[model samples]
Target: MLKRIILILLVFSSSMAFSQNGENTWNTLSKVEIEKRFDETLNFEVDYPTFSEEVKKLNGKTIELKGWMIPLEELQGETYFVLSSLPFANCFFCGGAGPETVAEVFSKGKYRFTEKRITVRGKLEINAEDPMKLMYILHDAEIVD
Candidate 1:
């Protein structure tokens, strides 16, 4: 009975450790890389598509993005913010919400809304396009100090 209990405890502990470690597998990229890639336009003959390809390269990758947190009216309960290239007033809400202007971020918990700029690190998912009308979206995310 003692040996069986010890084995059960070991299994439970190992599973818990695995679950904790699994969430930390995503890798982070620098802000410079994101800016450099955004500035350059790659020419490809094949119909692989630029946005899709870029997204595929970034998928399952954790990256730190710096921008103002601009919330959407539609997404209330869910913590959704856009990482804009420029100021929120200048870039957003003027039909200027381009591919770079919008980055839908879903935080792990309730985030304190602020006007100050912040850096967020989370697993990026580029394939999940918004059903309504949106450009870039990131899911299963968390804010990094």
Candidate 2:
């Protein structure tokens, strides 16, 4: 029937549209690729890659993220680290992952860097600019039991 065909077409088009709206796009942004073109100026000027509105909307809200803990500092007792969707071997720094897949974590105490994926809850901050930091930040984050 024409009605059945039209319904199928509608569903197909909607799913196709969703595919291009930055879900896959965000997953493809590697740190190396983004770091090459993005900048954060002393005067607060910033230039970032194309970002999803969904990600920007999450800024400043309480969120629970599940990822692997990666050490970014050489200090013996550094609490600040990166939480990535992948393990250290496949993280952004290792050139096997993308930028959006990682977030800077600020924990009150030293967190043992783990090879296993873990979940942490905190305030999600989207840092489009800020050369001193990663693109995503989770403030006051804690490991979720």
Candidate 3:
């Protein structure tokens, strides 16, 4: 019983560290511009949204992103997670939002979740390949307020 109680307290504290009110928010969608490329020979081509010149310049630079924390797994101490524009039930993964609504977050350390919105600061890395990863990736991320 003691172990369970301790674990519960730790969970609550961790969640508080991550949760935030709706005071500060970052807009990532406008940073990129979507373009369509047509290749008649191939059935599919690169039609995904492309990052604008300004956004591309931000690559490998430290930046702060605001979004709701989405746990990749039920286990705690997850180093990598997802940040969504909406809540879990209405996030991009749930088909209620667009592709630009979610980003794969790779923090400097582990991150836990609360229902409140949160902000993260890290080095941004954009990937055009590797479907296993999200196009917008934040590396070396840390929670800020």
Candidate 4:
């Protein structure tokens, strides 16, 4: 029947649309690649600007960033952690816990804080100014073993 055919077409179209939106477009770079780009070339004079530029270029794109998780005070029963580019002492928050000190990451499920080092694979989001205050600021974020 024409009705059955129309229903099938509608379902197919909807599924295709969902699939397109759900596509993962993040690119993964190896440690070697990161070193090649940042190691020797990164120094006191140009580190921050160069690093910021690279991250900016990957905005809205998926990237695997490896860093440490620094724990913050818990609210209610949920534990909050900060993903930092360096060790806890070097964290921007070490002095005053500034906005750039850490990134607020909420685990998908119940998780306990153990090691400070962790690697995260997620969509690169910028100017997330306050992850705790915003909803859905970062998408499809998961811990990488």
Candidate 5:
């Protein structure tokens, strides 16, 4: 009975760890190389990010991210917004961080703007060729916390 109980506990712990795979996804996504590339349409050089192999492996996979909501249009209950590693005051647009510090979140439902940190889960899509779009985009995202 003691051995059986121990085995069950070990199995449960392992499963729990696996279920939290996205807990530190932001750290892995940070592994990127940025370079300036000239865009013919824009007539100027734009910063382009090349995702690392570790980051590419996460593409098309469901992951979770924790960050602050950034409203672009000052609209309430937005279905899409930017998620930043830092708060609005220290975010990328604020000139305190880089583009990689933020991800475009396209949620399934409208999310009210808040100063609190929130967690979201969705399938991550990497955009390397589009200069107009963010480097990281979370599709079908929903608030987890």
Candidate 6:
């Protein structure tokens, strides 16, 4: 019937729309490729990232990512920390993983350190200019279930 065909088309269209919006994932963020370039100001070579079109599109957009928390300071009431795609022993700082595997997270709420993987939502910023910071920065982040 005509009504059945129309309903099927409507459902298909809605599912297509949902699929297009579901691209915010860690794999999409890992599309960035970096090359070491000499910085005249710092007088040293630093890794500079070249973000792919997919990763570039995520800049300034609120995205959700799941990662293990890397506490910078003490275990209690930490407002800022690093989130790594890998666990503690295999993280960027300790293991051989690249900078793309980590993100600097800045949150207003204090969080207790946990070894478990945590999901966070925030606006992602790609830091190409600041050598002192990580290549990926998450601003106004909050831990989510």
TM-score of 4: 0.47
Cα lDDT tens digits for candidate 1, 1-145: 9999999978533322111234311111111122112212343221111353444666666665656666555554466766554456755555453344456788887676666666666666653333343334566667665
Residue lDDT tens for model 6, 15-109: 22111256536777778888999999999999998999988888998887778887656644677888887777878899998888888889869
Candidate 1 global CA lDDT score: 0.50
Clashing pairs in 3: 108-141
List where candidate 5 sits over 4 angstroms from the true fold: 1-19
The best candidate by lDDT is 5
> Model 6: what TM-score?
0.79
List the lowest-lDDT window of 10 residues for candidate 5: 13-22
lDDT of 3 by residue, 1-145 (tens): 9999999988644432221333222343446665556555565554466777766776787776666777556634687788876667877778556666677787777767666778787787877644446677888888787
Clash count, candidate 3: 1
Clashes of each: 0, 0, 1, 1, 0, 0
Give the deviation of candidate 4 from the true structure as CA RMSD.
15.3
Which stretch of 10 consecutive residues in model 3 shows the poorest summed lDDT?
Answer: 16-25
Better of 2 and 4 by lDDT: 2
Off by over 4 Å in 4: 1-53, 75-80, 95-101, 128-138
Candidate 2 global CA lDDT score: 0.62
lDDT of every model, 2 decimals: 0.50, 0.62, 0.66, 0.44, 0.81, 0.79
lDDT per residue as tens, model 5, 1-145: 9999999978533322111543457677778998998999999998899899998998999888778888666755888889987678878889667888788989999988887778878888999998999999999999884
Question: What's the residue-level lDDT of 67 in candidate 6?
Answer: 81
Clashes of 5: 0
Q: How are the candidates ranked when ordered by lDDT, highest leading?
A: 5, 6, 3, 2, 1, 4
- Residue 30 of model 6, lDDT score: 75
Q: Residue by residue across 1-145, what tens digits does model 2's lDDT show? A: 9999999978533322011233432232232224355233555534354556666666687666666677555732466778776667777889665667778888767777666667677777777656677787888878775
